[model samples]
Target: MGNGVKAEIIAVGTELLLGQISNTNAQWISEKLALHGVNIFHHSVIGDNYDRLTSLFSLAQDRSDLVIVTGGLGPTDDDLTREAASEILKKPIFEDQETMRNIESYYEQNGQSMSPNNRKQARIFEGADILKNDVGMAPGMAVQKDETLWIFLPGVPREMKAIMEQSGFPYIQNTFPNQSPIFSRMLRFIGIGESQLEHELRDLISAQQNPTIAPLASNGEVAIRLTAKAESETKAKELVQATEQQIYERVGDFVYGYDEDSIEETVFKLLKEKNLSISAAESLTGGQFVERLVTLEGASSVCNGGVVCYAKSVKENLLEVPKLIISHYGTVSEACAVSMAVNVAKKLESKIGISFTGVAGPDEVEGQSAGTVYIGLYVDGESPFAKRFYINGDRDMVRTRAVKKGYELLYHHLKQKNY
Candidate 1:
């Protein structure tokens, strides 16, 4: 690869622009390209009109050395990428007999009659390399036209991903041997700020060359993506891992997860592994906390139930929070939060119970101001601990922030307790 093959993504489906189907394929391809250090210079989304598609293809050819196109490989009339590609490149399309036999056999096995247009699925460029679609009948192709390499893929997400992982990634690797592939690892950290986290690892960030550190913000959390470029994939990962180790040595405690690891996922994995279970009492979250936890597979083993005590009466009556305490301290107090947590665990028959109680509001409640929040955790044979925050945001933001803080505390507590 030469200076990491410059690439452009062209999504060829009118349905995408029409908002009928999302262009999820672009995101998948872009992430895959990033992993290999491919630089995506442009992302062009065009509809089914052949003239516009051809013009877009021509423009891509002039600007990028490698153009990745998704969609328009279907057997219907709207599927026009292959035809447009042949016309724009002046390459004759011919049926691949092997692919044709596979398609025919697929239809026969399903006991369905093949449509006349299905024959178009077997067509390829005059001297193009065929990419097999294991998940679907439509065969993808890689063709060279006007010094630009074009990679065509199906629009269906599963079909596209299967081909990319099994064949497409390898194909691009072989074709672009001169360009260095990009590789990256993301360190997911909670209970840390973007600035503070970087401050701890500023030395590593400032002194960078082959590998670079880029910090990204995600809803109340931060992920520092350590990207490294090298001719070999193994070398690139080694570079990333080395950088990650140095950073982790400084602030690994705040690091709760890694790439694609959400707080909920981390909680579920740890709980499942240790054969532990959890339940929640959501005052501000309204059962949202437990819903997020139990959404993962096998969560039923740990997650039993939850309560949404949006009102003082519910907290007092349903969760056994003393009505006298609420009358004195209101529903958003630390006592109320602790009670909610303890009671919910008893009610749910879970090993642990957590609760959210706060003024997640645009309006003040009782003596508390908007953004005033409390999170309580109650584990078996441990004291119920509550943390308070005075976050400044809108009503939804405050509630969401409070919910995330509860999980972060839960994650840290569980990690410390188990280890």
Candidate 2:
């Protein structure tokens, strides 16, 4: 395969298929393989059924150069990964004495006798390398059948990670010595849709090579993942940075933060940089905006607290939102939002104030449809204003998007002021 390995991760568990547990192992394995420059092309989740497991194993062997299977390695009858592998590859399964000794030693230390079934944890395919597990009883194993290499690891996250780190990665490096490592960076953006972001970078995506560009959307935000492969990390980074600079030249304004920087964290950082503090008056969002801000480190320095004024009386009395404005334009209106923002800032003695008032529901409020939201912002020495948005989703989704949009608005304003 020209020194490149095409890998597939197969997670074996009925719980995963039933949605009782997430297939997080596959995600973890894929990320690790990427660092080794292994191209992971497929991920499959199969139940404990022996026939289905063997069928999937046959298909993976035919298509992939390296196949990694996680889970189904326990001592229970339902654990069928090793059996399926043996059947598919026609290899005899034998117990490794080193692993059996370790398992027996563990039971001895626990003041108990080892059970007969526990020997299953020590089983390995003929002519395979035994991957020692320092964290658990099950020892992982790897075998090469024809052109395909198959690896079996425990389903338990702790044990699987230990084996992979200790033996799995080393074996892979030895096998694929000529493969170049990969480096990737995620550029996160707000105030833009996925299709629009893709359209803006169409040329770069179409002519992509070396460092490839991928657009992903999740939870009201879009991200571009730039991946590059090179002999050294520095060279890969340089390639990715060159592409990143070009993307910024076109859509930098919408780009908020890189990697794991959330909108709330971005806003908090801006507030810290500007030496400003903020308080919120939350309605339909129920203090969610302020909750996120307060969770960050050093939040006490910039967060002045907030008021969850869900009731109109609390808005008029607690936050001192003007009763006349609420009566004239309704509580879910721009006038009320502006009044709440300005008054909350005055009451809390903060340098900046933000407010959320919305109809987040399965029903309408005051002739306004569900998802009707008004976000108000008041910065000290600046005019207070409110923006209306028609968000779409259920109650929880509407509230979530409303909070995200609030952070987005604050981010843009702080960015524009350059404070």
TM-scores of the candidates are 0.88, 0.86
Model 2 lDDT per residue over 1-419, tens place: 11468899999999999999998888988888887788888999999999999999999989998999999999999999999889999999999888899999999999998889999998889999999988889989889999898889999998999999999988887877777777899999999999999999999999999899999998788999999988887888999999999999999999999987888899888999999999999999998999999889999999999999999999988988787888899999999999999999999999999999999989999999999999999999999999999999999999999999999999999998965
Error of 2 at 163 (Å): 4.3
Runs off by more than 4 Å, candidate 2: 1-3, 87-139, 144-147, 157-167
The window of 10 residues in a row where model 2 has the poorest summed lDDT is: 1-10
Instruction: List per-candidate RMSD values in Å.
Output: 2.9, 3.3
Ten-residue region with minimum lDDT total, candidate 1: 173-182
Candidate 1 global lDDT: 0.85
lDDT of 2: 0.92
Task: For candidate 1, write residues 265-376 as lDDT tens digits.
Answer: 8888878777877888888888789888877877788788888888777887888988887888788888888888888998888778898988877888887898998898
The pairs that clash in candidate 2 are none
Question: Which residue pairs clash within candidate 1?
Answer: 1-177, 1-178, 1-179, 36-182, 37-182, 277-302
Best by TM-score: 1
lDDT of each: 0.85, 0.92
In model 1, the runs with Cα more than 4 Å from the true position are 1-4, 18-22, 95-122, 272-275, 367-370, 391-397
